[model samples]
Target: MTIKAVVFDFGGVLIDWSPEYVYRQLIPDEAERRWFLTHVCAMDWVVRQDGGQPIAEGTAELIAKFPEHEVLIRAFYERWQEMIGGVLDEGAATVEKLDAAGVPLFGLTNWSAETFPYAWETFPILRRFKDIVVSGRVKLVKPDPAIFHEMASRIEPHLPGIEPHEIVFIDDNRKNADAAAALGWHGVHHTSAAATEARLRELGLPV
Candidate 1:
């Protein structure tokens, strides 16, 4: 089927988000920083925050588990904005191009509901999306079919019975791309703006 809308993943794909960016400022020691992130402020713990867990509650839980790293653990949420390096210009330009071409744009991101305000406030380009399904808001993260289905379902209210197959989903992770592909959506495992633009052109988009 022909593509109708373009769905984008936020972190790593559209914007540069990494816990290390925040931790590097707090913990100056390289090896110690890696260990703290790996063991204390692990991705597993942060993903829970992405799935709607309160940052305060999550930080408390981590601090309880590792009392010695209290300051560092709190910094994870206290300085969450520092984690995002800023929007990736190359990738964001594709989004802008698609928007200018009158293509429907949407975002499907795994981000903390508590911290998303920082991004929402920081980046003006993000406002261009017609709609966005944040995993934190819905308590559902991708690679799960539920999140994909939820996003697809939401689109119907706007587009009136648009099928999942009509959306082109772009993500940096292969598994997330594969999951959307399984649902009959066109999935682009994005590496760079040039490659994504090429794919869009192949799909006959005006971009």
Candidate 2:
């Protein structure tokens, strides 16, 4: 298969982000943190923000529903930066190798519009992408074919006449990777940095 450029999914693929990072400090008790994440600040609710819901609105809605855990709910977004540990070591290293090899890298991420700026500001790796299509800014989250198409559109300008099959997409989420595959884009499920690098090499990419 002829490949044009490789697209990367941000959070799990490159950045080490999780609510657990901050919650471990705030909640203290593992069991209670688990319950709170499961019952209150569920991933679905968090994902809504990723798809463009205002942070204030999301936090307020959750706070209203679970007034008993108001402090915990508020801390979800208020301390959003704390949830990020840093760039994944292997992933960052892999990106650097790819960059040096002149691979065309691009980003497609399900990140909140409000919070994505901080990452963009801090991580030089993210700046390596020729362009990035952020879910929150466009109101289109992944696993939805529309967002993948949006990525394709953004990529067209840099690598003209590129077809879906010519692009390789790497994502940590199997579902999102599968979605890209369904659209005829080659999908690499990023389980580990080593695995992702190997997969890209198999695809004839520089990495």
Candidate 3:
């Protein structure tokens, strides 16, 4: 089947998000900042929150391990909006084109349930999506086939009888893109808005 829909990954693709965005100001020294984020508030540890653990609970767990960094740990979730710079204009424009072309657009993102609302409020472009599957809400993260399947199944309500292979998935992570391809979906390893839009165009998408 020809690609009939586009599935997007939020951070790094459509919107910019990074612990560094928050930590840089808090922990001025680059080395200490990297150490704090890696050893204390690791992405692996943070992903548990993305997998549905409450942000407060996740922070407490980290605080237990690194009590000295309690305030920094708290800031991870408390000021997460600082991590999001804004929407990527290139990606946003592509989405707008796809939306205007009447293509079904959906989102699959590994965002904290507690913090995702901030993104929803901060970025108006996200509202264009027909549906969004948040990892925190669903307890599933990308590079896991289950989340991809979940997105596929959920989108059925809007685009009935749609096949996974007929959807084009775009993500900044190569592993996530690989996982989507494993399911026979056309995967676009997004690097920049221009490159991603080119890939979408190559896939015969409206963008």
Candidate 4:
């Protein structure tokens, strides 16, 4: 099938965001930071916020569960902006290339509604995409077929009757890439900017 649009997963692919950035400075000890992140401010816990749980509510609930770590828990959301490392140059360049080539661009990201505004305001490259489907906005995260379906529905207004096979999805997580592939779309597991761009070219995209 001829590809008609490019769907990008913003966090790992185009933007460099990791909780470690915030914790590293606060918890200088590597082991302690790992322990805190793994047992307390875990990925699962963070995903809940990405799925639409209010940031304040999530933070309060976490502090309640680990009263001793109140300060740490507060820091998680308090210093959330530090987690965004900024737009990745090489990766974002690919988006620019595609856009300049006249390819339709869109974004699908698992980001907290409460925090995404910071990045949205900070990065100009993000604004290039014609449309974006944010997990927090819709309360559905990636790897869940529902989120991809939501993306498809949103893409309809721009590319009418577009099929899954006609879109290429780029995600850094293998699970997300596989999930989209399972749904019949061409999913590229982005390991690096060079690799992803190579794969996109192989898929017949101008970039």
Candidate 5:
């Protein structure tokens, strides 16, 4: 079937979100790096931020847990900005191609509300999307069908004639992409902009 829309994941796909980018900058000492990753990274406190916990509250909770490393904890919370650079120009160009070809575009990401505005500011191309579903604002994360269902619901009203399978969801996380595929949407595990463009081309969409 011809794809009607393409959904993108922001972090690993459009923007550079390498944790090491921030860790190397903040924790210069190898010992401190290992310690921070072991105690803090493993906790996955960012999940709370994505799960609708306020940034201030989440940062405070993390600080309380690691009272001795308050500065490190704060740095970790603010490190998202450091990790984010401008969108991949090639990816932005591909999105433009897809849009010009009449394929609807949307963003489905597990991003915090606190960071979304910054992303919008950094990537002006994002405004071209018809819709965006951010986990922090919705209070639901991906791989949980609720978020997918919410996205489907929002697009369904706009595309009453389209089938669920017509929406191609592109995400870097295999689990989330698999979950979306299982729910009857077309899923693409994004490896690279080139690879994704190839897949879209296969679907008869110009990318």
Candidate 6:
């Protein structure tokens, strides 16, 4: 089927999101870093926060779990702004090209609501997309079919004549790309913007 919409994952695709960068910046001491990562940097805490749990509550729960590191935990949660950065210019340009071609653009990202505005401000190109389905806003993170379905529902309505298969989903993570592919959408495991643009051209999409 011909491509209709091009859905992009924000983190790792548009913007570089590395937890290690944050870890290194915040927890400079090697011994302290190990402890914080093992005990305090809880995935559940991140999930709960993304699921719309109050930040204070998530921080408090984490603090309660690891009382010794409560100060660092609070600092990490509060100073999230120091971690995130902007999207690369070349990638942003590619997205702009796709948008200009009348290809419906959308974002399906596992991004925190608290940090999205920071990302948006940093990457001005994000404003061009027709729709943005964030996991934090929807409370459904990807690798889960429901998040993909949620995105599909929102995108399908916008492209009235197009089927779900016509949407091309791109992400840096193989699992996410594969999940999208399994759902009958075109999925690209992003390596470089040049390669991705070539793939779009192969699909007869005006990149």
| TM-score of model 1 vs. true structure | 0.94
lDDT of 5 at 153: 77
Summarize candidate 6's per-residue lDDT along 1-207 as a digit string, tens digits.
488899998877788665556778777898878777666776656766766666788888888888987777887667676656557666787898998888889999887787687787777788888899988888888778899999988987788767767889999888889999999889899988999899889988987
Candidate 4, residues 72-144, lDDT tens digits: the string is 8999888898888888999999999999999999999999998888888999999999998888899999899
Selected candidate, larger lDDT, 3 vs 5: 3
Q: For each candidate, what TM-score against the reference?
A: 0.94, 0.97, 0.96, 0.98, 0.92, 0.88
**Pairs that clash in candidate 4:** none
Poorest stretch of ten by lDDT in candidate 2: 198-207
TM-score of 6: 0.88
Instruction: For candidate 5, give the lDDT.
Output: 0.82
In model 6, the runs with Cα more than 4 Å from the true position are: 29-35, 42-44
- List, residue by residue over 39-79, the lDDT tens digit for candidate 2: 89998898899999999999988888989999989888889
Candidate lDDT values, in order: 0.88, 0.91, 0.89, 0.93, 0.82, 0.81
Q: How many residue pairs collide in each prediction?
A: 0, 0, 0, 0, 0, 0
Q: How many backbone clashes does candidate 3 have?
A: 0
Candidate 6 collision pairs: none
Clash pairs (backbone) in predicted model 5: none
Candidate 5: C-alpha RMSD after superposition: 1.8
Q: Which ten residues in a row are the worst by lDDT in model 1?
A: 156-165
